[model samples]
Target: MSGRLRLSLQYKLFLAFVLIIIVPISVVTYVTTKRVSRQFQDHNRDLIRSIMEQMVRAYQRYGTSAVAKMEKASHSREIQEISARLSLTDSLGTTSIFEALTPEQITESAKQVGGPLDLDVFTILTGDGTIISSSHYPERFGYKNAKLLSIAARQEGVPFLIQEETANDTILTVQAIQRIALDSATKSLIIAGGYRLLRQDFLELILSYGKASLLFYDIPKKAITRLPPGRDGNPTPFAQSPDLLKLARQISEWPNNPLQPDSGAAARPELQAEISLGNSTYMFTGIPLIGVDGAGLGVLLIGLSQADLYRLLRKMTMSSTIAAAIGILSALLLSILFALRVTRPVKELSRAVRSVALGNLDQTIGVTSHDEIGMLGAAFNKMALDLKDNREKLIQIERVAAWREMARRLAHELKNPLFPIQVSVETMIKAEQRTSTEFSTIFAEGTQTILEEVESLKSIIKEFSEFARMPKPVFGPTSVNQVVKQTLLLFNPQLRTIRLIMDLDDHLPLIMADKDQLGRLIKNLVSNALEAMGEQGSLTVKTHLGSPKVPVGAGGTSSLASEGAAERASGRGIEELPALARETWVTLQIGDTGEGLSEEAKQRLFTPYYTTKPKGTGLGLAIVQSIVADHNGKISVDSAVGQGTTFEIELPISQPSLAGTETV
Candidate 1:
């Protein structure tokens, strides 16, 4: 009632996809977004820390240079040399500076000591803290500067000085109080005057430096200015950064004790990490440049920012997240595509099978891919066609089998009656009862005719019954090689006239069958071969082994076995010449050298009682065909008009019981 269903799997798959794949993917996308966000933050923080360390290193270099400047200012070696020329005896003694050096020579020596520590203002102080050197102005070098001298003298070894006023910024007053040499003994005197702090190079250095804010103060005139401090305690850094100067009161004394800003102080340098300048974060560092004599001269302050660190981190995280998402999405999409491509065909084949389950043999799984799936689709089509054809063939075979069984039954049932009738007819024909030539001739002729006809009738009934009622085979394990050998031996007498060849492989597995049926199968084939060859022709028996074709249950089937031997042989009997036909069949190929029949003769060869021989019963071939059918074997006659005939019989290679085949 159904016109062939032409629906494709894609239509059904549309429904299947909704049920299986689409919904879960939506949930996966939602989960992935949240996971991506958390990973971004952690990645950026690590990048910022690395940039901060680089800034720290740069700050350290500027600070160390300031320390070197302080060392040059405070070596104290030049001060010791100046003190060596002067003499003083304790608080009451005095020594003549003129004895060590004239004014011109002293002035020249001062010029020779060109640095901050070796200044031209080389002067000597008396034991009573009086300046005695002529290098300073006469009024400026003595007790008139008692306040500065007393500061150094009272401190004994410490280089103490008050700041001196200058025309521009200021000068340093370094008065290192020491003992003056007198009669190989020491007296309380002091050597001073590296007070001229404004070396031009030093001034230039103080101005060029940034970050280290300065405060230059003149103790004499109290002239204070925000001058940037140098490594030496001079006016440097005070002018560098206005902000640092504004916060001077707080930062002038750096590494400030307790570190925190003073209470009620106007400016408080709270030592900030100056996070950034120009969109970058920076660090502010302060290093104390100590004099060689261990006085806190001044400080070097720096600001190093790291905003680039933050920017780099932000860029890195954003880029990394985008790249990661793209990669993961690409992988996911490709995987989905690949999986669907491979499984699509399998699903199509599955649906096609379901249609077939409902007895839709015309349904086909069309080719979808060039790979294995396409091959499977073609194979399915072939299998469906084969199954449909085989189904029809089975019906025809059943009819043939039924007819054969009936013939065998009829042949069996009538043998009892046919035997006695034949006996009576022979006796009647033998008894003499002729009176006249006409009467005697008529009686003998008539009796002979009746007897012959009855016998013919008997023969017909016997062969038909035998053909119709074929026997069931009793099966057991028997060697196929042995069966072939024994059957050929039985035909040994006939073998003398015909050249025989045997090509059989040993080590063949045993087959299951009934012996008498198998023997009769062989007998029919051999007899047919003898008839085909006429008198002397070659006969060859070949045997080969392979895996048995057992029935498989698949594709709406429960028992799908191969076409077995007996019935197949019976069917093939239809395609033989009428002359030498039929026999019971098995897996024995009995070929003969003789003139063969045409295609037409081959087709009608196994029809009931069909005969082509002069004196032979056609029932012999028919009986052979029926017996072969019962045993599930086949007999096929392959021949050409002039060529010899080959009757290839394929039997179920099962061994048959010896008792069952005791008589064929």
Candidate 2:
């Protein structure tokens, strides 16, 4: 069998507990982790969308404020005066305008208007897109500002953002243009006012709503710039990172551009993605920045750090694992305790059963509860009680039956002798009445017959007396081989007609027994073997130092001999035999090749006065059993009709000290 199948009940119960407790816990943890992860992602997505929307609204508010300021600056008195002068008509009665003042005077007027309105660029332009005067860029006073003029042609006094190239760098500006007509022929002068869009100001405005970093993707240049939230460092680090550049390109292609004018009818959801930068991760969303003319200016990326969320998830998983471990351990402990609690009674009951099997009918178990185990304990106790009671009654009945059998046999034996004597005396009386000679002859023959019958009766009575008064063994060290040899010496004369076989073990250990009784036991067994073999048979005697090959049980004559031995050894049961006593036993066997006994005869062979031979007094074998039993040994007969019989005896090598024994 596999090791798993061989596991004891306790381990099996522990595994059951693990499956019942830990499996569900693991499953629940897995499911809950998945649910929580999904929720966190959904919540993060919603939060990022909210932040993006707020950022867009803030940008819109700033733009609206800048446009309002530019509009206010346009209607200023200084700008109006500059526009009036720049729009002076020529004397040719045409719509063409002229510069009515010196360039220095026009520049001074642009500065006076721009300085108070906080404008970054204030310029006066001709109808043909030439800058007449400039506040922020005086060097470009006469330059043809083609980009501004193109926007001016399209503008209707509404403010819009545009990128302007200065001598040093490109800058984004929010500008508004207003026209000043000189005549009816469409010749006009323009006044343009705007504020510069600085990177630091843009980032500051974005950071006002949340703690997130920003990245700007300039669509035209195909470049990505990192806009840190702080105001001190270089706000725009135009580092050309390939990974960031790739992300920016991907964002630019997203269809949901929030700044698209046509996107108002559809949902302008932010395009979101995850990216790892250095050792940290970020969740980024893209919001496109489109100009008023529907031209793509750039994409603005807002990123939120995801390190805290990851840490939280890790903590949750660890906590669940710890809890599950504790639960499994607790379940295992409980299972062990429960298994012990459940199996303890069964173990006790099993031991009690073994004790009862060994002839100890007084065994019992404790019943502590009303559960099934407790009920089993109660049942075992009841069974033991019943067995003990039944055994006592059986022993009483057996004693009664034994006495009745002995009485009947005694009566039968006495009747046979008495009948012969009675007939002999009656014949003597009849001869006495006939004649002196005949009477004398009859008297002599009758007296001899009567004497012979009386002698037979005396022998029968003597045998019965010896069986009834068997003596306690005086235990001492005596060699079993020596006793067997000595006993066989008495049968040497009868061995002449029979083949004598002696297989005595020279190494047989000395046993503690009464020498006289031990010799008598061997003698009786040998004598019976000789008589069974008749005139032409074999007689075998063997001695060994071990238990019988086949186990002898209580159902055989061996068990009866053990019971008798136990009764003689202080009225103790067979179970009371010490372990050492049983281990050191010596075995002796005597066999004869004669007409073996039948099964029925073998069973009753040890019963007193139960003999099979026509003229045999069964007390011979009965006395043999009694002597062996007195020495606390066992005897059995292996026999079958026509096959011969063998009597085996087992005696302890060294008997334990009893109450009155001098040597043990």
lDDT of 2 by residue, 1-664 (tens): 1234466667777888888877887788789878887776687677767766665565555556655765776677865665566546552111232236655565676788777877777777777777766787766766787766787788646667677655555656667777666653666767776766544565676666454767878899887767752354433665566766676776666545463234551223445667777777777776766565667677777777777777877887798789888888988888779877875556566656644543455556777888888788788788878877876787689768866877888898899999999999999888788766778778989999999999999988887677666777788889888887777788778888889888998888778788898888888888777777778898888888766646554233333454424332222433344445345678888989999988788778888778787886688888787677556577777777888888888776754333221110
Model 1 vs. true fold: TM: 0.36
Predictions in order: lDDT: 0.49, 0.70
Clashes of each: 63, 0
lDDT for each residue of candidate 1 in 331-398, tens digit (9 for 90 to 100):
55655564576556666666565344323455666665567766787788798678668756985897
What residue runs in model 1 are displaced by over 4 Å at the alpha carbon?
A: 1-435, 485-493, 547-587, 604-629, 633-635, 653-664
Off by over 4 Å in 2: 1-3, 9-43, 89-112, 120-124, 131-147, 158-161, 172-174, 191-202, 229-247, 260-262, 265-270, 314-318, 321-363, 368-376, 383-664
Query: Cα lDDT for residue 446, model 1?
Result: 60
Provide the TM-score for each candidate, comma-separated: 0.36, 0.54
TM-score of 2: 0.54
Cα RMSD (angstroms) for every candidate in the order listed:
20.4, 9.6
